[model samples]
Target: MRVFRIAKKQYLEDLSGEGSRLFGGRWNKKGMPMLYFSDSLSTSLLEVLVHLDFKHLTKDFGYIEIDIPDNLIDTKLKLKDLDDNWRDNPPKSITTNLGTAFLKANKKLALKVPCAILPMASNILINPKHKDFTKLKVIKVADLDIDSRLIVDTK
Candidate 1:
């Protein structure tokens, strides 16, 4: 499988599970570096966050890993009423739709890609498995193939 990467500033949305204080304080408003597999950052993933948990990479697994969900979203809506619903019960999940990607807690069952969270510093400074994965390679909606398949090592 190909590993796509992003910067802490490139993350499309706020992270869930992490409380507002922790995420807001730790992460900048732009978001953090992340990796995932999908057709376009806009649609969905074959895998979503389920079993894997993230922690300091070196101490935990040396590499935080996430799977690319194969779920393909059908229709997308940004109804004003949807936001209005927030008055009574806004989605508890952190839903985000950045120009580069979309992330949400309550995303439709088949509408999210499994993603692995890692340190932006490590991705930039450390030795990535692939020599070709340049410091310039940051995950974006355009980077993913239209089919949602990650470009893996040709080897």
Candidate 2:
């Protein structure tokens, strides 16, 4: 698949480390026409936005960034190989407040979504750790009917 390099770069910059997005990462007024993320989002979240057909959003789009929830949890698994367990087991319903917010926000966007993706962002680290938060496995592409209520059409 073709990648939007610019968008990818902007996505990474906003989510350099652990932080809260100023305003839900709606647009890229500060970054390079990019999206944003906060602690609530896992790398998987970036992956979701990076992918998917955003043709309607703009042809200037570059990449889809994501936040993978529960990355640190997997890091605690204590695995020898990088792909030890090699499983994509996401928990049902998000537990964190931010996660719920993200789900609700994305759920509204899902109306326009045509599909979903998996980033395999969960894994154990030998030393150090990513933020340890439970992953949220919500319904993909279930809310594609993005109307005025779900998301405000700024365009």
Candidate 3:
């Protein structure tokens, strides 16, 4: 299975999950290393765009395509499996706790979860500590050109 991650150009080559670990995210708490990937390029873009602003708009950005063996992703968490407020903006503990547990368990390299921005779409969470994490393959990485319309002059 192929997954996509959008990030700054310089960090595109760094798959260490260090950024996510230090800052945490909707799924993982601070200090937990986890890589977030979207099923499609468009979704990846959207995921990054939400966290970006005009200042970040001018910076170099890129996207990465990673290939993961289908069998490695044996676990999935559907929308129905989550609480009604799972999509809350601040991200409730229910969601983070669930993800934290998954990472601690280290039972699977990848977990299929619903995207909060677009529930119809899905995001893949990767546990860098997983034993089979090395099985993930980085197939492609290239510059991402964000639409000018998406940027606004704050000044």
Best by TM-score: 3
Q: Write the per-residue lDDT of candidate 1 for residues 1-155, one digit (tens) a residue.
A: 21333223233322231332233211112342222333322222222222222221111111122332223232343333133322222222322232113232323222322222321111111111222323322332232222313323333
How many clashes in each candidate? 15, 23, 0
* TM-scores of the models, in the order given: 0.20, 0.23, 0.92
Worst 10 residues of 2 by lDDT: 123-132
Residue 89 in candidate 1, Cα distance off native in Å: 30
Model 3 misplacement above 4 A: 153-155
List RMSD in Å for every model shown: 16.7, 15.3, 1.5
Q: List the residue pairs that clash in candidate 3.
A: none
lDDT at position 69, candidate 3: 96
Model 2 lDDT tens row, 74-148: 222222322422222232221123233433343221111111133233211111011222232221111122233
Q: Which candidate do you rate higher for lDDT, 1 or 3?
A: 3
Cα lDDT for residue 18, candidate 3? 97
Candidate ranking (TM-score, best to worst): 3, 2, 1
Report lDDT (Cα) of residue 130, candidate 3: 90
- Cα displacement (Å) at residue 99, model 3: 0.8
Candidate 2 residue runs with Cα over 4 Å from true position: 1-12, 15-20, 23-46, 49-53, 63-74, 77-155
